[model samples]
Target: MVFCIRRAYRSEQAGFRAGKFLTNPTKAGRGHVNNLRYRSSTRKKVSLLLMLRSSARILLLSQAASSSFITSSSPVSRLQSAQFRTSARTMSEMTPVFTKDACPPAGPYSQAIKANGQIFVSGQIPADVNGNLIEGNIGQKTEQCCKNIAAVLEAAGSSIQKTVKVNIFLTNMADFAEMNETYAKWFAHKPARSCVAVAQLPKGVPVEIEAIALQ
Candidate 1:
């Protein structure tokens, strides 16, 4: 558009200079010469306005095309699309872990969910595979909880050795020592752990344990 405008301006100036030479001042009166100059000035003004309008239209079309390209091909737009696809794939790849070897889930939840090369085991109380609560002290209860976690990990193709984090909930803080005694024997790798005294546990159990492990 700019090139077109420059060309038109240059041609108009050249025509104006040529008109001076083309018209013979000696063959006409002063009034006749002024009238001819007025007509020439009017023609050039009209031509310039037409050229400017054409340039404006061309500029608008070029801007519209550029905006359309940016909307469809910008980096931010492409990145957002890729992230959405990755999230959907991760959600679809998640696999629920369940086994007859471990105690059944007491509520409407999976025993464990395996996703992104990790196992997320739900909290396990001191119960057998039949969902029967085990009768024993805190140490025995802790042992049963660890056993159930081991079973769930095995079902998900993971193991106690790979356990990365453990959470232990107890109804009484005094039971911490006994629970640690049994817990240390199971988690020899000494993964990160948190033990908190809660007001109560499901089925009135003294302790419950949950774990996370890398597959």
Candidate 2:
């Protein structure tokens, strides 16, 4: 009896290792073990297929997110695009105005700049075309400054009559009456104007003038 029990125990161990079991040790029992093995193999294959499908879904989602990031219309990006367009348009429209009929600029700046349907004249002191300070009283000095502005406007395809704004700088308010007298002769259309007194002006002149005129 001991020998027969040991033999049966060894047979059971060998069956387990081979993916089979001997419950009844008959033909029907062997067929049931084969059915169990088939079910286990089917489950493993189904599990592998599910895992592959899940990985593919994850990869597709990642690719879609990357594509969305490339075409993102965030606020900062939109603002940057707008600013670049504005800068490019402004640069293309801007053009410098120069003429020997006007006083030469005393510094590293254009005598006038034309852009956006307007001409912007730089501050003009009482100077001649050669950049020499003119010899005159306050009224004459103001007239000379207006003449320089007119020349710049003409060069830029604008005119003093089309001036939309004028900015006047004076070293003394006492000369306002004289300056206004000469200014009215030039800007008779009564464009927008602002006059202010400063400590001094360029080239030691008592007055400086600048203007903006429509093209």
Supply candidate 1's per-residue lDDT for 178.
Answer: 89
Please, what are the lDDT tens digits per residue for candidate 2 over residues 1-215?
33444555455445554654433334566677775775577556556555665676787798889778755766777788899998899889999999999899999999999887888999999999999999979999999999999999988888899999999999999999989999999889999999999997777899999998999
lDDT of each: 0.88, 0.84
List candidate 1 segments past 4 Å from native.
Answer: 1-73
- Model 1 Cα lDDT, one tens digit per residue, 171-206: 999988888999999999999999898998999999
Distance from true position, residue 86, model 2, in Å?
A: 2.8
List clashing residue pairs in candidate 1: none
Per-prediction TM-score, please? 0.72, 0.66
Best candidate (score: TM-score)? 1
Candidate 2 C-alpha error for residue 46, in Å: 11
In model 1, which range of ten residues has the least summed lDDT?
18-27
